[model samples]
Target: MFKSFNIRKKIYYLSDTIKRKNVSNHLKEINFILNNPESNKSKIIQKSNLNNILNHATNTTPFYKKFRNFDSILDFPVIKKLVIQDNFNEFQSYPHKDKNNFKVSTSGSTGVPFFLFQDEVKRNRNKADVLHFLKRSNYEVGHRLFYLGVRLNQKFSLKSLIQNVSLIDISKLTDKAIEDFLEKVAKDKNSNKILLGHVSAFETILKYLDRKNKDITNIKLNSIITNSEHLSVETKTKLENYFNTPALSRYSSEEAGIIAHQTIDSPDTFVVNHASYYIEVLNLNNNTPVKPGEIGRIVLTDLFNYAMPLIRYDTGDIAKTKVCDNGSIQFESVEGRKMDLVYDTQGNVLSSYVFNKIIYKHYKKIKQYQFIQQDKKEYEIKLNLQEDKFPFEKELISEVKEDFGKDANVNITYVNEIPPLASGKRRKVINNYNKNNSLINPALSKHESIT
Candidate 1:
């Protein structure tokens, strides 16, 4: 099966480049220092490694050359996704040999599809983040389940074949095929593995569970891990109700494996990977640190990636910080996305989190729902729910009206299934309202919001 094949492929990839110094060695070296944090040697190791990364990025990468006069960390300008996308090759340590590197393109779900080169060190750090997150979530690396996504490598190639356990292509979100795939996962015995994918893909599955009135509590699962897309509390509660498992939200990107993750012990707040990367929650007006517990934009400086350094890079999402009494950082909550917001003509901004909370509170029979803002103050609600309770659609409509206010136009539509975006993350709320003026302030980019 693919489990073994993936292992074999990794072995082969390593064998082919053994003389070039495998990524595993670097990981082991860094992990040793991270694990033994109490040792004085930790500081020595970290400073030495970071200095080397900075010098390498400055000397080899074209973009960094312009920053030769960079004085302090604050003096370095924020790197936007667009800037990186346009000059990806120039950002590389070996720009001319970009194709020779392991080039990987993102799913482009959030409207940015671009390629990134992953060197051995970056790859190992990425893997470490994933493994560390899985450990925190009470799951292992090789848990059994149908992994969903488009196969990147060739179909017959050993790499491609190994990546193909339960691969489902989801370029289109609204599809019967996607529903069928979910049904299989729900029924398959071999899938005690946690259901994992973008928020959109899992939303589709959750909708199916709601519509059929299926007892997801009966389904076997270790935990439900949501990534790529925002994990709204509404979706989290619905997923937990059906699957009878704790739903953990993970914040990650293709460029970085695990930025923040919810541990099995602490399902609420996401702990930053402080050892791997330095995370800062900055004010939108200035890159100053936000007051404790205040909402701000999430910026990152990846301490690991040397081929391309990201100093104070904007991640395009908003988050609030909550430092525990013990001084550990955790997120109080992450708004669905900075761009995903709805507003009314009167200028009252409705948060996706608010919609999700209201719906979950009022309608228990409702399975999965999506809120679409067609215009200021106009909206449509879509649902996929149980058969016997299908008649309860009217009640749900009334509930939305009650929560959104009486004047808000609300329409209820029934669909067999709901699909996710190309990135496989399901968008719970789609705002078509003009960006310039809305009941709420327009969503600011991570960097834009934070200065």
Candidate 2:
């Protein structure tokens, strides 16, 4: 049955490749560069593409017009989310035409929203890039993909069937909802299935399955790919162990289609998609390129999005980078956003994953939880309960106090709903202390201390 599904997927991809004029060629070119990362041709192609996009941005975009004659890409100032939010009109290279141009808004996970426009071709390229990456994981075009993320506005139709995606709304991630989703996957036993979504959503589902003692062997999955949030080692391990498959972490954003993905060869490190965008790790203070192995802010330049070229756009995430022996740019470790870390009373910093694991353990009753670190000593936890009254409220508080410290002021506020970020993303942990500290701080450089 799996063999038949694979054959059908292959046939569908081949037919679609023939129908699409230039998509196959684009995929081939990207694949070639990916296969030969160290080749001089690859470097030349990347440089040429970057230069072309930079030139286009300078000439056509109002935001970059002032830097038209900029001798070097570095000379141009870096644009932040606030700049894009305020001067949105200036960023557009051309006026939007219905159906021809696609408008997308960032999930405002950073508290500031950014609206972006892309040409139809660019949109197709984004989809192509995703397909190309999936192919590397031995995923065919028509394979079953369980997407546990936002509910797309489009209704189910032929296109949806062709895409072969089963959308599971992250908002409706209750225990019953997860059980139903699992049951549906169980029914389709033969199809090669892949789970893709935000890390928290997958974690929630995993916890639900674990709590119910569900036999994951009955619903086999080929791979698990998580994005939109930091995929921690613990979460990845849990996913891999439960699904009996490799869990791949994808680093991406709405502004940028897919910045990096963990390949089969390098499961620990994320290799940049050189064909789609150019990545640079720059110092947060001066925007200068940081040395290999040093942590720095991520800046990306979209090579394909000509409708609104985003050159040297600060991605707000911090990561360490190194040029591998094969000459590919690899992420050493992604610490996520500067404001994503919580500092405890002992001045020990904790990754957002620390609290996520604790909260998700009680996911059946706690529908949603947001940890807000007001300061080193004061903490506020807001929860959207599955029931009117939380039965384990005392246990939850005790567990939190144990981690935070006995003297710490940990307040629990029950709310009907926790507001999502501008990007419609619900952050598990929010560090209010670092909200205004945009620049990289020395404390954040230290590794996460659980105690």
Candidate 3:
């Protein structure tokens, strides 16, 4: 029932896909040049192309031109959520087209759910990257499986009908749908195929699968391709151990199709997609280039996207840069969203994912809690209790101290409720640390105040 698109449509889809795949391969060569000091001529070509593209966009697009005078990428001025939200039209390099292409909005997990348009070139690049990463894990493209969040809405949309004929719904990850999903996964032969979805949804599904004593590891499936969320080492291990397939992490965003990716040579690290775009790891505060092995914010310049030029755009992700022995740029880790890092009293930089585990471990007595760190030695843990749970609180403090340190002075404040943000996501932690400095604030203390 599920067949490929008709000849004309399939041709349309494939041509763009080929362009993007070609772009991705080109990027690899460019990255090879950038990583090697001896490939000086390649660097010159890349730099020249970048400058020309930036100049063209600046002269042609009103909003994009503002960054031209900026001496350093850091000086380009950060694009806050409000700026992008309000000035989307100015961000577009090409004139808005009719609905010949696709448009989707960001989920706004970071308080910015703005709509972005994707032409065939952008869409195909994305698909190619996913397919390429999957192939690395020995997965073939013809494998049968269910895909989450890939929809072509138009009712009785041609694409929808095609999916209905071929794809089975194991159910989406929701309170109402999860039980059915587990049952379907267990019974369906397609479960032995690749299960592709967002990392968070996949993780939640794995938990339920593990609890039911269903040995998914026995399933003859390829590896999992997880994107659009922070995939931690712990999460990766849990998924691989449970599913018995490698979990390949993909680094991408809407602005740029495929910025970086993991492959056989660098499984733990995301190599920059040097063919289609250029990547820079610079100090978030000052925008200066960070040395290898140093953590910094990620900035990218899309070389091929003349539609909406993203040149030296601050992507709001914190990561460490590494140069492999083979001389390639490796994105060691994506440390949550750029503004999402939490600091402890001892100035330890902790990712929110790290704390999520601690919270889930103590999920029994804790109704809800918000973590706020004011200074190097002070922290406030505000929580809503199902019962008094005072004993658990003391134990939590002790555990946190052990996990963090004795130097950390933590306060457990019991509250009625911890409010969800406007975007409908629960922001369980907030750190009012200095954005100007890459380091955590040593002077932060409890009295620093909470709004």
Candidate 4:
């Protein structure tokens, strides 16, 4: 009576006996966050969980031993990746959960990786959250999921395979690979199919498919989940139309498995995973949480990760938290990390997405554009254009200066091409002034060939 996977469902059982290894009660928790988050029962559950997590942290971890069980969770300091790494030993809880413990690291956004440990509960919760969202996009447990990546290191996953996930390395994606993937899609018509990939990887696939005039109408994709890079409106629409399915941008990180993700109706807004995490939006100046409309740090307190407790951990990303009339929590216009954040002359953080917003309109004329902050109040926009003439130069300069403050110096550099990194991804914005900005690469030139 031993089986590798769980798929059976019985009618009269009190509990679903046939359950997967990673399955948990997290589905109920996730639904509470997504649906009845403001209900009294939900509030009590959150309060109880928070208190328990805090007590566990205080009792077990060396870093939180200073704060007694009765101390407020807010009393704990907001931590970054650097802080954890410097005090790595202190964050670890006692009794270790040694057998079930596993190490996970943040490797994508910043080149420098920060390691943390998570027990089975945390891992199961992560899996459950992902499954919940996948279900929203019409994806089922046994559905075929294709994950495309840029310069992928690990090509295989046992858990992913168990969940029927096929990893397709799109680093140097060949015509044969595209054809093979599509052929599989064509073959599997009865079952639901999913594509989880980087925005760039999807773009490459779309371009290749378009070149060959590939008809994907019969491919029957259940959903397309784009991750890693930002999925622009144009990209999302194209993918959705081609596959005749929903294109959802998943807001996730290695530190926190599933932070937030786009819903079917509203592509822009992300529904925060408040079930597994207690999300706080804190302003740049003081550590206080900002108003719903204002931009601030997307701080998190993992409700489950007692193995390596992350209390008030600043994710370095900026977003506006919106509380709707429906009593649901949502994150809007979520931008890049703190390292890439734009700052005014007075060291006040401004929205770094200004450059991208301004340049997006002229994407046809301009092949690629990058906004670079060379020094304090000194910025340069490197433009790789399709045509020799650009009429918006002066207007764009003035607009950018206004956003950066009165003291901002803005200049435009026309280039033949904006060079891509070794991984073949181009950064839209960068801040070279701050050494703390982990994404900075001084050796990287603004342009491949100056015009």
Q: Rank the candidates by lDDT, best first.
A: 2, 4, 1, 3
Candidate with the larger TM-score of 1 and 2: 2
Q: For all candidates, what are the clash counts?
A: 12, 4, 8, 0
Which consecutive 10 residues in model 1 have the weakest lDDT in total? 442-451
Candidates 1 and 4, the one with greater TM-score: 4
Task: Candidate 3: list runs displaced more than 4 Å.
Answer: 1-49, 64-89, 94-104, 116-120, 149-179, 186-192, 346-348, 353-392, 402-429, 432-451
lDDT of 4: 0.74
TM-score for all models, in order of appearance: 0.74, 0.83, 0.72, 0.81
Q: What is the C-alpha RMSD of each candidate to the true structure, in Å?
A: 5.4, 5.6, 6.8, 7.5
Off by over 4 Å in 4: 1-22, 150-162, 174-187, 206-215, 344-349, 362-369, 382-426, 434-451
- The number of the candidate with the highest lDDT is 2
Rank order (by TM-score, best first): 2, 4, 1, 3
Q: Candidate 3 — which pairs collide?
A: 26-275, 27-274, 27-275, 345-376, 374-444, 374-445, 375-444, 375-445
lDDT of all predictions: 0.65, 0.76, 0.61, 0.74
Give the lDDT of residue 171 in candidate 1.
54
lDDT preference between candidates 1 and 4, better one: 4
Cα-based lDDT at residue 66, candidate 4:
79
Candidate 2 residue lDDT tens string, 139-175 = 7777888887666554776555665777777776777
Clashing pairs in 4: none
Candidate 2 TM-score versus the reference: 0.83
Q: Give the winner by TM-score: 1 or 3.
A: 1
lDDT of 1 by residue, 377-440 (tens): 6878888764544665567667667766677788878776676555555567777663444332
